[model samples]
Target: MFGILVSAFNVVLGFVMRSVIAKFFAYFVMWFITTEFVSVLQSAGILPTASALAGAFGSIGSDVWYFMDLCSFSFGAPLVISAYATRFIIRRIPVIG
Candidate 1:
């Protein structure tokens, strides 16, 4: 699912970004990009199979807004949290001289 994909993306992004910039900025930028990407896909109706599945769940209403919100939050929350947490831990360990 998208949630799993987002989590994996975050893990990779965190690893890559840490070497390029400060932790906070890296985390913020990556999180912003990922969230924006998801939002854009939702708004633009570009999500894979979304249109096809729309009719199947018609009784629930159009577009499944709640489901999208849930997916985004479920996927994005852990990534955002881990981004900062991992950085914090790395920074905390005393370097062996």
Candidate 2:
């Protein structure tokens, strides 16, 4: 029946959406952890990072914030799509009760 198929689709959609969110968050958290670890490693060595010229060699501080921001969006866009699709499906569903 159409209703039964819709029910299965709904369940699968929810599962897939949740899976995507879980994976993205897991990877994002790892990035945060790595950043902290690297920061500590840099500071522990008493190295000054103010000079941009020495950045490539890991002796100076380089701007990694921009790159992180760019990469974060690749994960965020899917979340946005999943959220919108969930909303649209819920709205389109008819209540039989």
Candidate 3:
């Protein structure tokens, strides 16, 4: 009975560790790729800078500009892109999808 319990515990621990490591690796890869992609976009001038966004919002009105600043397009663009990228990647992975 003690041997059986020890075997079961080892099996469960191994499975948990594998799951945690795989998830951590996946998250790290996704983050690295997303940041690189976002940086490339920014360098290419496809994505505007925070100051540029603020400047554009300046003419709109204080209320609207304040709202824009609060929402923060510069920050949001990467977040939105990363979400789609993650979804696309997950769907492409046959085992995970």
Candidate 4:
């Protein structure tokens, strides 16, 4: 009974650990690739920087800026981008998809 219990525990633990490690590795790779891709786009002037975004926001009327600030668009933009990126990456992974 004791041997069986230990074996079962080991199996469960191994499965959990494997899952955790796989997910961590996948997310890390996704993040690294996303970072590099964003860097290249920014360098190429295809993507605007934070300061440029802020400047554009400033140029807009105060009411519009206030609405944006209230809606927290600055925080939402990156979050939405990350969500889409994760979805894209996951779809590319056969095992997960």
TM-score of each: 0.31, 0.38, 0.49, 0.48
TM-score-based ranking: 3, 4, 2, 1
**In candidate 4, residue 9 scores what lDDT?**
100
Candidate 2 lDDT by residue in tens digits, 1-97: 9999999999999998899888888778766665565466567964335464246435423366457466895577558866874465445434210
Q: What lDDT does candidate 1 reach at residue 35?
A: 60
Cα lDDT tens digits for candidate 4, 1-97:
9999999999999998899888899888777776676667569986557798677667788788789889998899789977886676557555455
Clashing pairs in 4: none
Better of 2 and 4 by lDDT: 4
Per-residue error at 48 for model 4, in Å? 2.6
Candidate 4 stretches greater than 4 Å from native: 49-97
How many steric clashes between backbone atoms does each model show? 0, 1, 0, 0
lDDT of 3 by residue, 1-97 (tens): 9999999999999988899888998888777776676667679997657798568656787687577678896588679867886686567555456
Residue 56, model 2: Cα distance from true site in angstroms:
17
Model 1, span 4-91: residue lDDT tens: 9999999989887776567667568666666665566567975536456456546664367587676895578558766874565445
Pairs that collide in candidate 1 are none
Tell me how far candidate 2 lies from the true structure as C-alpha RMSD in angstroms: 18.2
**Segments of candidate 2 deviating more than 4 angstroms:** 46-97
lDDT (C-alpha, whole model) for all candidates: 0.63, 0.62, 0.75, 0.77
Q: Best candidate, TM-score-wise?
A: 3
* Count of clashes in candidate 2: 1
Candidate with the greatest lDDT versus the true structure: 4
